[model samples]
Target chain A: MLTFKVKRRIIYLGIFCFTLFLCFFYVIKTLNQSLLYFKTPSEIFDDQNLDLSKEIRLGGMVKKNSIKVNKREIQFIITDLKKEILVSYKGTVPNLFLEEKGVIAEGKLKDKKFFIANRVLAKHDENYKPPSENQLDKK
Target chain B: MMRNLFSLNKIYIFSEKTLTFIKSVFPVLLILGLTFALVLSPPDYLQGDVVRIMYVHVPSAWIALGTFSTLTVLSIINFIFKIKILEIVNLCIAPIGLLFTCLAIITGSIWAEPTWGTWWAWDARLTSMIVLMFFYVMIIYSQKHIKPKNRSLMFTSIISIIGAINIPIIKYSVEWWNTLHQPASIKITGETSIHSSMLMPLMLMLLILLLYSALIFLMKYKTEIIKVKRSGVKRL
Candidate 1:
């Protein structure tokens, strides 16, 4: 027979384990239910059930040579390689927003082909490198 | 073996020696880390000098996550084995964890304005970090205001265990969801994308911060021990 202290310890351990399992279950369930922070251009195009009227964030790389500056308004095409959506915004873009750079635009989708963004955020990759000589010269 | 190693008398003696050692080494490390971080580290190709904020931001976030994980484990052991020392340790750690979490969030916000064009967003990563902060606050609050020492310990353990669930979510949030926050650059298992020049400074800063944390923990632990002794608490 186990001592009282050992028994109590075992009981506490059992309770901790049970609580941990419950927490894990809750986290998994919640994470599974629409926790997406942003939708890519391809995801928006493929999903027929996506509500276009509700404002959502569209994230992808800005297509090369697709940026057009018409006065204060900026137009660019965001592409996930498989699909692309035209994004139009009338404000200042972040310094990092450049051709082929990752970006997230928060707005309502006008249609499958166009997104009207109120805010455009530059999303950089994890990679970090020193500027090359030519790029440093340009700076 | 573990019990003997963690006994109050042994820990008290150990803390004294560790404190002296840390005090001496801390200044040297601080100078070295600052020089490497601010001067030696190369500017980023894209973000330029603004990327230097990462030296502080990443380390703070890492320590915040690490402290909470440590607290949760200690709380579990304390709850199961009824170790009084672990309770003291958990109590001291909670505030430090909260401070670092706040530091991480602030530094990240400062960094975000220049890079992401927004001060804040309800992204998965950012939201989960905020939740972690709330957990720390809850633990600290309960520890202070809860009546009956045993009940306080129980509440802290339970809250910490529940909060532990958020840890994994914070780490994987970038991958599991498309967040404005970038994915991890430094990985334990895989190849790191950060170049060695930047990586060196980052590591130096992390080491300095970790040393600072150790120094603070030892000082706090010593004070708690003294307080318990003065109160004539026989549990220790």
Candidate 2:
């Protein structure tokens, strides 16, 4: 007959191994999904086979003077140093969303050159402040 | 052996001291941290008043991560050395750590809506933190189910060791992956990317939260000890 302690030890080991397996499986799945969810303008440009209909995130810096605010929609260009893709977003934009800053737009691409963003997110660097007020005025 | 590790009389004195500390120091620090965080801090040039959320959000995140790391180390020590006091310390910290983890997620979500334009995303950093919370829940649950003193400790220790692997993943997730969450501003290299103005309130809040967690853990630890003693048991 198996001792009580041995049986308990066996149960503990089983639970530990099971949980560890599940944790790793979940981690791997998340890592794979992240790669698919995140893409730069250049990556989308390079990947011709990427689905245009599905919603995706395109991250890049907003090009200077690319913003055009109209009555219904706001349009801009997202550039990843090497390539640029035009994006048009409707509804209110984030407060921090500005020109010459990093941004991520989530939407569907109409074609290789144009992206229709449903939601636009402004990305800022780690720096808390944008230099002094007068310094910005000097610029 | 457990009796020697946590004598009843010593626990009485320690709990009394902890209560006094909580009553005296905790309130002062809480008020100061809140004043600096909510009122004194300047609004962000870009985020404006929404930056106030960072005062709570950042500290909660730091404590959540810090508590988990502390729990993992204590678990390893308890497992290898078979120390009962270490196990009690480990158990006492889990609930507090879980609370901070939940706070971090809630605050982050609130901050995200206005800042990131989304309440939640399955990005690398956010998902990893959710996973860490799940791990904490599982560890807390297993403590109740596993029978036998040593067996429970072994299981909890193993679970914690496994979960510790996620801590590093959470820290580096923003850097390693392109996620909605931003990279860390305060690094250990003493080279902060944020301005001194914002960093001051943030640091004060962080220190206050750390102190608050210590106060909470001390109270919980004393309660655990009293409960164990009342039950006339040497091990929990």
Candidate 3:
């Protein structure tokens, strides 16, 4: 039969375990933040504390003639209203990885000031896709 | 007798049980706390009102790693102790962990598009999260197809433990390579670390997220237990 001492030990032990998991969980929760989560090419280079494991989003135009593809890796340039940034990828190119298209690459930013993309999503012109030749008449 | 062997009331009688409860409730409370920080806590001088999103975005990212850490530690513990609860906990944690990881990626992107002038960057954290997302998918996929009774828990626990490699990958993601995001905050030790004002909200949000995680863990654990209990019964 289980004695009171045994049961008490179990209770105390459970509480101790709970506290420990909470503490470790808290450490990750509280401390893992950054001054910034996104970066333009200029900002990527400007900030000195950049890291590799962190997740980031890089946005810009797919510079014409700048894109280079080999196997799964693709490299291109992104530009804002002001400056240009270089980006590299080593995965299936998102369908919209075309020149002059607005693209957002999801991947890592390197210390080299270049971004290594893993996925890409293209932006369509806000003007909206033209209706199929017949859809215009459906209205 | 077996039901009474480790009953609900008996949960208080086991250290593992207590750990389970705390693990379950932590995430929910953390999420609520994040909401508070976002609405009530101080805002960033530069980002203003919108800055509040950072509180949620950052901690969600934080917990994504932490949740996976649970998988890692519990999996290791599972290997060492062969406890049933650890496997249950790991299964329950995966869905929420993946959700938070996805949330972090999405929210971070929204924040970046404006502030950084781009929608995405191949930063250290960003890449790892994508990896984290893949891990989450594989874990969930494995859990679904694997035999429920055939040492799957042990195998999954091992998977969870091994998956822990991502945490370090995430932690050092910024350090090992060059990316656009900054380094650790509460855990960092550099001369130019996060300011207290930022830290205050971050802390509050983190507490909320911790609570939130526990809440999530418990909710899922309870449901899983119920599923287990029903597994053997046939209803006519």
What are the models' TM-scores? 0.93, 0.86, 0.55
Q: What CAPRI-style quality would you assign to candidate 1? A: medium
Candidate 2 ranges beyond 4 A from true positions: A1-33, A130-139, B1-12, B233-236
* Model 3 Cα lDDT, one tens digit per residue, B69-96: 8777776655554567667777888898
Model 1 lDDT per residue over B163-198, tens place: 888999899989877889999999989999898889
Q: After superposition, how far is residue B121 of candidate 3 from its true place, in Å?
A: 1.9
Error of 2 at B201 (Å): 1.4
Give per-residue CA lDDT, model 2, range B176-226, as digits (tens).
778778889888877986778788888889888887887888788888888
Pitting candidate 2 against candidate 3, the one with the higher DockQ is: 2
Which residue pairs come into collision in candidate 1?
none
DockQ of 2: 0.35
- Model 1: TM-score for chain B: 0.96
Q: Score chain B of candidate 2 by TM-score.
A: 0.91
Candidate ordering by DockQ (highest first): 1, 2, 3
What is the C-alpha lDDT profile of model 1 across A15-132, one tens digit per residue?
8679778878786777764677789888887798978889998999999999999987999999999999999999999999999999999999999999999999999999887887
**Model 3 lDDT at residue B194:** 47
Q: How close is candidate 2 to the true structure, as a TM-score?
A: 0.86
Q: After superposition, how far is residue A44 of candidate 3 from its true place, in Å?
A: 16
DockQ scores for all predicted structures: 0.67, 0.35, 0.03
lDDT of each: 0.90, 0.82, 0.66
